[model samples]
Target: MKATTARGTIEAGDVGEGRPVVLLHALALSGRLFDPIAAEWAPRRRVITPDARGHGGSDWDGRPFTGEDMADDVAALIETLVGGPADVIGMSMGGSTAVLLAQRRPDLVARLVLADATADYGPDRVQTWAERAEKAVNVPREKQVDFQIDRWFSPSFVEANADEVRRVCDIFVVTDSAAHAAACHALGTVAAVGELGTISAPTLVMVGDEDYATPPAMAEQLAAGIPDSRLEVLTATRHLSLIQRPDVWPEIEKHLDA
Candidate 1:
């Protein structure tokens, strides 16, 4: 289904019949990234997955946007669809957005799950992101697939799950360079650590032991900063812990049910 928000039209998948749970995707990916999670949760909970503004079926005007803007988009989504606070699970970039959502619109979030995400990228992130944005705009997406794959998955995972890896790669290659650059810039500008204490909802900060993109230290920071939060590090996983380690769902399920 589609909902008109303050930012733009947001395309989402709403299924099941119970308390709502919103699943947000990582950068260069869409709500479709949560298909497995949606399918699993739909039997017991309402699963709502919306494509972040610039990726997948969602609309983006090629203008620059911040993580807070993305969070507001989610805020509008919950108000229009769920009609109340819902459990929110965000991965990577989406994780950062979830933190902003909890900080800026606490009423819209009940339980929070941040997977492979960080509150801040540090002082050098600006130049780092600028360089990455330049690459996204200048380099062909196909050329960058290997680098992304290596960063997203562990060596064992890539060796064992070729088809799944390919599926994610296809999504990455099709993403518009401009949109990817915009998201990179937005991620670089994130600085939400100081606001973590403001989040009142129970929170779970999960990360991969092998995740270099948003490492375990970052998860520790999230857990330490948030008033009611804990950290869990999945063993032998990379940036995409949910995909790389499906067993982690029980932990997520435990948290949600708590």
Candidate 2:
């Protein structure tokens, strides 16, 4: 389905019933990436998954997108669709968006799950991200997928999950270069660690021990900054731990219940 937000229109997959739980996806992926996790939660709570602008069925405004803009889109979705505050679980870019959402509209977020996200990439890493953005925008689409998969998953996992890797690559192939470029810029520009102290919602910062993009060290800093927060490290997983390790859901479930 689609929801009209103040910024533009967003495509979403809303399922189940009861307390609302919104799942945000990473860059170059759509709401469909949450199918496995959403199905698990659907039996107990309402799971809302929305494609970030320019990624899926959502409309792209033909401008560079920001953390604030993406955050507003989620806030608007919660307001118009869920009709109230909702628990949010976001990974990668979505995780950054969730952090911004809690910072900008604490009233709209009941609980927060920041998976593989960072509050700040700092000057050095931000520069690195900018360089990556430049390369991503110029590289051939196939090489782009190869570059991203190398960073997003561990080598062994990639070797073992060819079909899954190809499925994800398909999504990356269709992603608008403009939108992807904008998302990369947003990551480099985000510096919200100081603001994280003001977030009042109970937060869980989870990261894969093997995640190089947003490593456990970053998650440690993120958990430390938030007053009511804890950090969990999933072993043997890379950037996309939720997809890499479904066994971790029990731990996530326990955290959500708390």
Candidate 3:
């Protein structure tokens, strides 16, 4: 369904009907990236997965946007469509947005699950993101796939899961460079760790030990900053651990149940 919120028209998947849970995808990925999560959760809870503006079926304003801006969009979504506060799960760039949502619009969030995400990407990291933004804007899509695959998965995982790698690579190749570049630039602006104390929602921060993009150290920092949050490190997985490792779901389910 399409939701006309403060951010504009958002294309979303609203499935099941119970306690609400929203899943946010990483940069360059649309709501489709959460197909597995949605399928699993839809059997019990109301699962909402929206294509963050500029990706998939959503409309982009054709300008640069920030994590806070996207968070506002989600705020409007839950308020106007979901009818109350909702649990939110975010990964990568989406996780940054979730943090912003909990900070800036606390009333809209019930709980937060930040997977393979960070609250701060320092100056050096910002420079790296800027370089990535440049590449996303200028490099050919075909060439970008390898770069993404290297950052998203470990070498062993890639060799063992060729089909999954290809599936994600297909997502990378078709992503809109301008949108991806804008998000990359937005990532440089994240600095939420300092204000994490203001968040009151129950928060769970998880990361893959092998995730180079947002390593376990980043998850540790996020957990330390958030008032009483917990951190879990999933071993033998890379950036996209949720999909790569199914065993983590039981732990995630326990968090949500709590």
Candidate 4:
């Protein structure tokens, strides 16, 4: 259903009834990306997934943004619908937002699952991200997504799971370039490393060993920075391991369900 929040009309779903557990989608994806996962958890937790502004059915609400701004959007939704604290799981860009949610609005989160996100982006990384984003916003779409896709999946993943890669590739291609660009710009500005040690919630950080976009080393840095957190490396998978690997969710269920 659509509900007005601090940013705009926030598109969200609540499929179960219990302590709230919000799932945050990655940069190019909408909450729809979590439909399967949400269904799996619906028997117990209140699985709420919102299409981050400018994504899915939600409004673009326009322009330059940051991870903190995205977290604030989530905070507004929580206050309006959830009534109290909720457990949050964020993947990719969403994972970065989860960290901001913990830092900016601590009481809104009871616990957090940051899957494949990082708390640091040095100057070089920031510049590269900014350049890519700028191209998305202005440049033609000739070969924009090529480099990105290469960075996202390993050669073996593409070779072994050609079918799965094609499906995901279709989804990625359909995403709007402007929205993708804005999120890319936003990610470059977010620095959660300074506040990582202050996260008071139980946190779980996971990554795919073959994930090149945000590799296991970056995920390790996230785990190392957080005072109380664990780093898990799912073997034989790429950036989208949670979706690509068949047996990954059972282990994920342990941490998310607990």
Candidate 5:
């Protein structure tokens, strides 16, 4: 389904029937990232998977946007679709956006889950992100697959799941370069740590012990900052642990069902 928001037209997958559970995707990925999860949870919940602006089927006007801006876009979508508070689960870049959403529009989020995400990227983030953005647009997307995959999954998992890794790589290569750059810039600018204490919803912060992109240390920051939150670390997992290890779903389900 598609909804018009002040930012742009936001497209999403709205499936199942019951309380809504919004699954936000990672950078350079789309709502399709949560297809399997959505299907599994559909029997008991309404799953909403939206493509952040500039990714997937969503719209982007070439202008730069912030995590806060993306959160507001989500806020508008929730108002149009869910009509009230819903459980929000975000991963990677999506997790960062979720943090902003909970802080800016706490009323729209009943429960929260931040997977392999962070509130800040530290002092050198600006330059670091700018360099990544430059590389994203200048370097051919296909060439970056190995670099991205290595960071997203552990070596053992990558060797064991060739087909699944290929699928995610396909998505990564096809994503718009400009959009990817913009998202990189947005992530680099993230400094939501100070605001984490303001989130009122029950929250769960999860990360893979092997995750290097956001790292478990970042997850600890999120868990510690949020007043009502807990942290769970997945052993032998990497950045995209949710996909790399679907068994982690039960842990997320437990938090949401609570």
Candidate 6:
């Protein structure tokens, strides 16, 4: 779970014991966000969820970063641990990093699951995200919690599972805003779409029906680009579908187990 980095020893919480699978988390969130979902992938498959560079417990180098840089790190993680290729699942911004890894070093990615991610983060989206991050930095932590809930969860889900939703929001508020802005910039100039079809991985593009962040349209766009890929939509869920709707894992399990 720990890898020696040029900067320091980076840690990733790993579990399960089958084919190696790497879990990349979303923007404004750390790898710990995957713990709940990681359980389903474990006990049968080896799942390694790392705190993305500059997020979670990982030391920030104070360097401006990009998704491509994160992708390069992941490709190396796979090569070092698995000795070659491995299946990768990325959620939200993590999905962008996943694709970048596959495209830049196809030999390191065996299969890809892009969940709640979009290829083109246009100017508008980047600006909005950047503005939001800017607004969040100076605001009190309490307000940041409210903002995350509104953007990432459905009202009904939050009402029914307020405590659980709060924990997810807590993670968001404590995350470094600057790191998020850097990732936003990375996605804004993202260019991995062209080589998607070249990916040999048996891929799955997943989204939640109630996901407001990246809707079904985005998932469909991914399926169209990744040759022979399939799409799975989790119902009655929001942006964090994997955590909000537990049923989503069976499909993911099927993908990994297959």
Q: Pick the candidate with the highest lDDT.
A: 5
Tell how far residue 215 is off in model 5, in angstroms: 1.2
lDDT digits (tens) for residues 1-258 of candidate 3: 889987689989899889898888888988878777788878888989998878877899789887778888888888878778889999888899899999998888888899999888875867888898999989998988877788788788888989878887776677888989988888888888889999889999989998988988889989999996998888887898777876787787788879
Could you estimate the TM-score for every candidate?
Answer: 0.98, 0.95, 0.95, 0.90, 0.98, 0.91
Q: Model 2 clash pairs?
A: none
Tell me each candidate's RMSD, in Å, in order. 0.9, 1.4, 1.3, 2.2, 0.9, 2.1
* CA lDDT scores, all candidates in order: 0.91, 0.86, 0.86, 0.80, 0.92, 0.77
Model 6: how far is 120 from its true place, Å? 1.1
Tell me how far the alpha carbon of residue 11 in candidate 1 is from the true structure, in angstroms, after superposition. 1.1
| Candidate 2 Cα misplacement greater than 4 A, ranges | none
For model 4, what is the error of residue 161's alpha carbon versus the real structure, in angstroms, after optimal superposition?
A: 5.0
lDDT by residue (tens digit), candidate 6, 1-258: 578654355568778888888988887788788888777668778888887776777766767676688888777677666778888999888898887887788888877888888776654866766676566456766667776677677788889988788677777777777666666666666756667777777888888888878788888877888886899887766677667767667878788667
lDDT of 4 by residue, 1-258 (tens): 897876688888779888788989877777877777778878877889998878777787577888888999999999988878988888888898999999888899888888878776665767877887888767655365666556657677778877766666665666788888888888888888888888888888989887877789889988998887888898866666566665766766677567
lDDT string, candidate 1, 1-258, tens digits = 888876679999888989899999998888888888888888988999999888888888878988888999999999888778999999999999999999999998999999999999988988998899999989999999999998999999999999889988988999888899999999998999998999999999999999999999999999999999988888999999998888888789889988
Give the local distance difference test score of model 5: 0.92
Error of 5 at 63 (Å): 0.7
Better-scoring candidate (TM-score), 2 or 6: 2
C-alpha positional error of residue 180 in candidate 4 after TM-score superposition, expressed in Å: 1.3
Ranking by lDDT: 5, 1, 2, 3, 4, 6
Candidate 4 has an lDDT of 0.80
Taking the candidates one at a time, how many backbone clashes does each contain?
0, 0, 0, 0, 0, 3
